[model samples]
Target: MFQETPQDALVGTWTNSLGTVWAIKADGTFQVSLSKNHRVDVWGKYTVTGDEMTIQESHGSHTPKSCRGKAIYKFMRDGEMLTFTKVSDKCKLREKNILAGWKPWKG
Candidate 1:
């Protein structure tokens, strides 16, 4: 068996529970928008290992001014499509949304 790389987790663009699209950049920066021309954050940090990935939300017009959110996801790749399930953790609201399959990822 071969060892897996952390970079693998950051390879695909993903959508949020609310149907927001977020692109995962090759340089570990992420861009997400809540609507057309209404980008929440132009850039943010990303950390990933194996099937798990976390995107750190940045300050922007689309995001809450006082909100500091991190989206943790488990990725599953099927051909050109990537399905990211939110990792619920201990947050009931977070868990519920993630498990509901509100997010999707693709090339």
Candidate 2:
């Protein structure tokens, strides 16, 4: 069971300089926006293990064509800096540390 609900913690707006954003809903519906003003609202069931946050965009209109392009943003940390990444079948590689989404409120 979740000890602390991100419901109160992660329930807010988060953005990256590249224009990607992660807006987490209290109920787990997540919305992500990209650099080109493109966005997808996903049914995101998430899990936080240590510094890693993994969210699967279960139900969204995101196309497979772009799934490997920019479907999701997975965040992790390395040593000190935070990293944002996306998993694309095209690359078959988890792009490492794109950019840590910005949250001024948390700072």
Candidate 3:
């Protein structure tokens, strides 16, 4: 039996410097914008244990090609800024950003 929701911290908008935006919701859904006026809507589920979180992209993008997959990440924040660092090499949404880390966004 579960008591209350988990990993509520991840439920919000996250963005990178490369114009990519991720809208993660608590209802097991996530949206990623790959470019201007272009976005990929997919399903996302996460498992949190201690300080580690695993994001599983259950469904890939609607586009023919996408970097959607499972990846392990660590959450960090500096004031209002939240970031995710890829601890696993499985996700390739943005190779450079993954290496450089992500930044939070409002839109």
TM-score of 2: 0.47
Q: Is candidate 1 or candidate 2 better by lDDT?
A: 1
**Tens digits of per-residue lDDT for model 3, 59-79:** 655422344566677776566
Better of 1 and 3 by lDDT: 3
- Alpha carbon deviation, residue 49, candidate 1 (Å): 0.4
Ranked candidates, highest lDDT first? 3, 1, 2
For model 3, where is the 10-residue window of minimal lDDT?
58-67
Q: After aligning candidate 2 to the native by TM-score, how far in Å is the CA of 82 from where it should be?
A: 7.3
- Given candidate 3, what's the lDDT at residue 35? 70
Q: What is the lDDT of residue 63 in candidate 3?
A: 26
Minimal lDDT window, size 10, model 2: 88-97
Per-residue lDDT value at 97 in model 2: 16
- CA lDDT of each prediction against the hidden true structure: 0.59, 0.47, 0.62
lDDT (tens digit, per residue) of candidate 2 on 30-106: 66654355556433565544444555444555424333233344454343334455543232212321344455223
Summed backbone clashes in each candidate are: 1, 1, 0
Top-lDDT structure, candidate number: 3
Question: For candidate 1, what is the lDDT?
Answer: 0.59
Candidate 2 local distance difference test against the native: 0.47
Judge candidate 1 at residue 89 and give its lDDT.
47
Candidate with the larger TM-score of 1 and 3: 3
